[model samples]
Target: MTAAQMTSTSAGDGAEVAAKGTTEKRRLEGSLGVPSIVFMVIAAAAPITVIGGNSPIAIGNGPGSGAPLGFLIAGLVMILFSVGFVTMTPYVKEAGAFFSYVATASGARMGVGTAFTALVTYYGIQIGCYGYVGWAIGDLVTAFGGPDIPWPVYSFAAIAAVAVIGYHNIDVSSKFLAVALVCEIGIVCILDVAVFINGGPEGISWHSFDVSHVTDSGFGIAILYALTGFIGFESTAVYRDEAKNPSRTIPLATYAAVLIIGVFYTISTWALVTGAGASKARSVALETVSGNANMMIDMAGQYAGVVVRDIMQVLLVTSIFACVLSFHNIISRYQFTLANKGVLPAALGVAHPKHDAPSRSSILTTVLGALLLLILVVAGLDPLGGVFGYCAAIATCGMMILMLVSSVSVFVFFRRHHEIVGNPVTTTIVPLLASLGLAACLVFILVNFTMVTGGSMAVSVILALIPFLAFAGGFVTAAASPRMRGRFMANVL
Candidate 1:
């Protein structure tokens, strides 16, 4: 089959065609520029505020002051993976995202698996963010004399806001995300700088970067958790059809996003150590920040004055909301794309004729998020532990699997295409090794998921396995459908 006729099957019909030969007009506008791409990356990266603000507290108390080292190790591994990831972007030419890449490399079954896993992970994370937003908003509201609202109310409010924003033009959302991203990064940077200026009680310490600290028993687990903070970095490719000169923009953005997030995290974690004192950092973090992110603002107040602290608090809330907005867009798009490809119901594939956005998909995602919030509120579960924890764990598992599969797809694509063989490091060696490394990390995270979160082994195991099950479901469905099965293999191989 020629590459031109192998495009993805539409919801209405099942047929094999090569992607290269198909002349379907691109529906998405290439309106997103570098600034917009940067905004998307930052919006996706905003969740790190919560992760960084709390992880040290969890680890310092449970695992020790070696938390910073764990972050550094994870950063290094991600950097290695990014080297190959950026290299692979120029080769793949599909808007189906990672599913397209996996299809081209591993055939229809794996492509379906990849797409399903991504959908589960994206929506799970989106729903998960609602709980965090609810908790954060509840704290903010209670401080202002408002009644202590239930988490579901806050979550529902957040979903409503996101739905309104998400059903609009991409440019509008991009601009909104850009502003929120700046505020989030600025607040975090201020905190980091304050910690540095105040200096540690014991003075500067290099122990936070020590290899021994990173190799600790819980260090790998910590690293795995830390790695999730960078989960959305690879999504640069998700905008392939909507990016100007994607061959260049996608690869550069991918690498730049990874490096930026990694450095930001390493520096931020290190600053926290210095700000809180290496010896007492963990204790201070747990006492202050873990239960309430506002504690960080209080610390900033003591060290940098009340004005800065108040400003930071406002920014934190905005950051959390921005993440809610960003993930809503991502999850909705995943649904839209998958539905267009016939994996999901066609209703989800319908783009708003006027806005050109996936209106139904966005509404579905927002509704699901609101529903999850209601369930958690009714159950009286701690939004943090019950909702956020479960969602984060599930999302992490899904993202890790996606990364592993993409890395392997990179290797397979290069091996089969052969045109890129001259650059073995970029095409074959780097991704192959990165895939193996990520696979090991994936196994480690799965085995230790319960210990890392201090949750029940049964709960953690079930949550961690959801993405894999989603993938298996897709594979099964694809195998059972002759049209899908034929189209997948014919185009991919």
Candidate 2:
């Protein structure tokens, strides 16, 4: 080739590389420090919502006394998994959390598969919250002697609000989440103290943690309930690319999220059991099974007074809103990553020049969630019982399986790249241990999904297998198309 022609080609290649490098670099604001990242992940966990919604079942339905142990075990497994997860962070600067990690360890085909699963799961969970949040808003109004609007109306309104929040700089959402998170935890602590002062129904006892109680009738289900509380904790890694000082920020945020949420679950659940009285916990929980979702509200009135109960009820709604918003942001970021990497339509990868957020991806996520909400409304399903219970369970189940895959993949990645150096615990053993814990949880969820959903076995089976199908489908699609595999390898793998 002529020198002039070669010179032009070289210039084009350099500019292309520079533009590629600048894509993620200039799109996200690096302002989300550790504390902000923590709020996002913890909010997604929705501590107040979990305690109010799941604790009664955990205490009464599952291993009665042994339920708290499930949190400890789940937390430990996550902490162990994080050791290897963050260890690999330095190698993958802007790659999507599980998307990149799974790709790097497995292959581009599998990575695309994992990305699809993560995307579907995050999207489903947010939609599930939308169903519940509308019902929550309706209740909030009627309880205050205000008019009760239809839930679908409230659901659409909430989707708009969340889309707006998610379309801005992430720091904006972080600050908002921090406030909601503090209120959620604060009220729980207040009620916890009051329960202690009032001495509970039968007074405090160690019966909540008794091994015999955990191994009782519904042992598998109790552990399932407790472990699901940590569903959003792994989202810490989701913000790695956008986090300030990502290497330091991610590990700290992840460890902190798991530890804080873990302690909160263990202590608050025990207090709840005591508040209801250990011996009477099962009976009280069963009584509430008909209605009265928030036993904390009941406990708040019993110990603190009526005023606290009302406030707690209001915060419960906000707690779920915060959770919905948090997941909205997560889904957008993941979709943006997929799009930019060629795993999805490129339109989703567009970032707002001014806001530095994935504007298009956020809007798409909002629209998709709204569409799901519409389907629920049109089907005339019960918002809380049918939509939230069924969709959320499937989402949570998908995430658990992904975590299981990630734990095992961490070991594979480190083992394959022997040149990659890290402590043995972080590189090898911890990943293996995490894999086992997550696998056990996945097994229980799959086997007992029908029982968990309180629905038809066929529907439960379909929901439970969504993650596996997404993962396998991604791999097969990629394997079938050389072009797709080439792009995944070039961009992400």
Candidate 3:
């Protein structure tokens, strides 16, 4: 061969190699079992936070003892939602969760839209959680005679801790969450059992599940609170690539986490009511100057005694840490996914050579977290009200919208790829049913958006508009990018 011809051939081979490298499949450490996934889900739910923060408001404002019924109702709805969600997981494989499923059915544009919605929703919620963590950790430190640092300072510290763990092996975060989960769950259970054994002034009765309270003025509010507690449950699918058995583990873990969160909240909150008396639960909750904020801590003293109460306080901080870590990992994975798909910077998708974790994305997440928390600190926003409350409200509403979209996508996906699935109910009928129920949920949440955010009508409208705008922005990006548009169109099953 001529020397010039040889040079051209060598260049052509190098280009093919580069192209193959670009398309290489990356895998995360798959040391996770069902238990690890469950811990991750429950940690994100932040059980102690809900029972302590939202439960009092639920019982005091809603139907008193009947508030536990809200959890049961929400759980049933989630189970129905899961019937379709889990059923479709086998056909697609990725940590993309709703974005992957949405794209599978609707098109790439909708997929990107879901991705943006999830990024906004999870990041918003994660930042909101750091607000609570800051206050809790700072208070705990001061109680122990530590320095009087600002809450946001403690928040930055917590973000730093998350960054440290998030950059390492996934198991490191998982094992820590498991330990945290056990401590928090154990303390809560002690309170639950003690309350059950001792009964209450009104008796440990079925009054909590009573049907008449269905028409109570705060019924919508109670359901809204119940739904918020399950915000991170769908994230079971996000750990698919890291699961020991994605098909079985993901589905079972999703179902178990939802039911466990629902039942756990239902019983714990009911115990609070029974410990205080049904008719008096609402009045007693409001009688406090703090109004339901420290109700659980107080109950731990009353039912489980002071030693347990102190332990509970300590565990509450750990619970918050576990949650922060869980979300840190989640958002990092999300960044990895978006980068892998060319939606974000490609460097965000690279795993650590030593840890096989999304180190780069995790680092980016940690930096973003620090920057966002700084904004809240500079703006002088209240950690509890402004950061935690408002962001959680908007994120919850956003998640519901994603769930509704996913439910419809399930049905559409099955219809389009009829050959891939067999059971009609699992694929189509149940998905359609879930879609209807989730639509109702979204409507109800929006109608009560002001109540959820504890803000004026204008503020509530803006909170409601955020998810829609984020989703639309993603759609426009996808439509405008011919490369992405073609990729989505060509990748259809």
Candidate 4:
């Protein structure tokens, strides 16, 4: 990647600015070549598998056979949003991911708030995956006469394993994610092919893509839920420091990941509808899959034989683990970046001397994840419901905020910098409108979060408030810190 032009400012006395106020070295040593980039893309896209594996069943029940239309609508909206998102990457240089975009577009305080909110959201997601991994392992073990392990035990174990992987070498994690991703995509493709060949229950219907379905009440709800599955796709920019050619690679990966994920989800959701039959699809999904994690396995056994079913279950387990590893690396890197920037504690910025990895941050991330897992298990909540639902909701909110900020940033940057507008209608105006649309979506999801997740009002309220609280806490801490107080004020003014 081309190095960013370094600019320095000096005081009247000619002394250099404090290092805290300067940008840090591009210290990421790993080379995220095309293969590794693909891994990152797929890992971020893995939640789509879970969504397809689970939510389609719920959507089928709620929106009838028109559920695929929801995925299509969400995918199209994300595509439009990506146009603005990809355009802004070349203009921003921070590694705090979306938080950095917000900082550059808005101001230091808002940036800090965004960073803290993102940290909470990403960490919650990483920890949330532990519960999912544990639940999957626990179920698999129970089938084999193994001792029944509690969800927290499995979660803790997964957290420890991910920590080790995340703290050592980026290449190692990328390779592991690559293997799991191939397996996941392969299985999903196979299922789609089988569904097509067997023919749909009621044949392909144009109603599946109708605008009315897109406008349905449950359709918007399902689209919001479906959009969450694609949350991590934006992380491609997070790896800019490590990318081979960031300007080209980041934009390419960003757009490529979104399109690939959108296509995969669209095809898979359609296959699911056809496999279960249009009229009975919802009931079939609920009865056979939503409540039962093994629904895919059972379906594979019936249509594709025992071998495929067994292989799919194994791949599903690996996919979940890959997601854990991916998010662990992401959250740890965010901590490392923020710490290095003096926005967080310096201790988190330390990298392993030999490994050149953020070892300390990784360990701390795992510890936080373990604590969250323990708290949920002790509270007697369903691990999947509490961990995935809560974390996913919060992460979704954080990402939506980031997207909104990035959209406005695009318009402002172009306007202020006098950059020529290319296709202003599609690029600027449409995305600005989409930003407003997404903001409305965010508020709707937050207000009716319980309905979206099928959780109690209290649980939904708490989960929805957590991101805001994290943002507030970060702002308060930054304002009070002796180290940051001066810089914060200077940057704001």
Candidate 1 lDDT trough over 10 residues, lowest sum: 9-18
lDDT of each residue in 1-104, candidate 2, tens digit only: 22222112122222343677754332355567899999999999999988887777776677655666655566666777777777766655553788778886
Residue 151 lDDT in candidate 1: 71
lDDT of 3 by residue, 344-435 (tens): 88677677878889899999999988888788779888888888888888789889989999999989877876556369878878888888
Each model's lDDT comes to 0.73, 0.78, 0.82, 0.70
The better candidate by lDDT, 2 or 4, is 2
Estimate TM-scores for all models: 0.90, 0.93, 0.93, 0.89
Task: Evaluate candidate 3 by giving its C-alpha RMSD to the native, one decimal.
Answer: 6.3
Worst 10 residues of 2 by lDDT: 5-14
Number of the predicted model whose lDDT against the real structure is largest: 3
List RMSD in Å for every model shown. 3.7, 4.9, 6.3, 4.1
Q: Positional deviation of 83 in candidate 4, in angstroms?
A: 1.3
Q: Tell me the tens digit of each residue's lDDT in model 1 across 164-204.
A: 99988777788998888877787778777777877767766
Off by over 4 Å in 4: 1-26, 288-295, 419-427, 476-493
Candidate 4 lDDT score relative to the true structure: 0.70
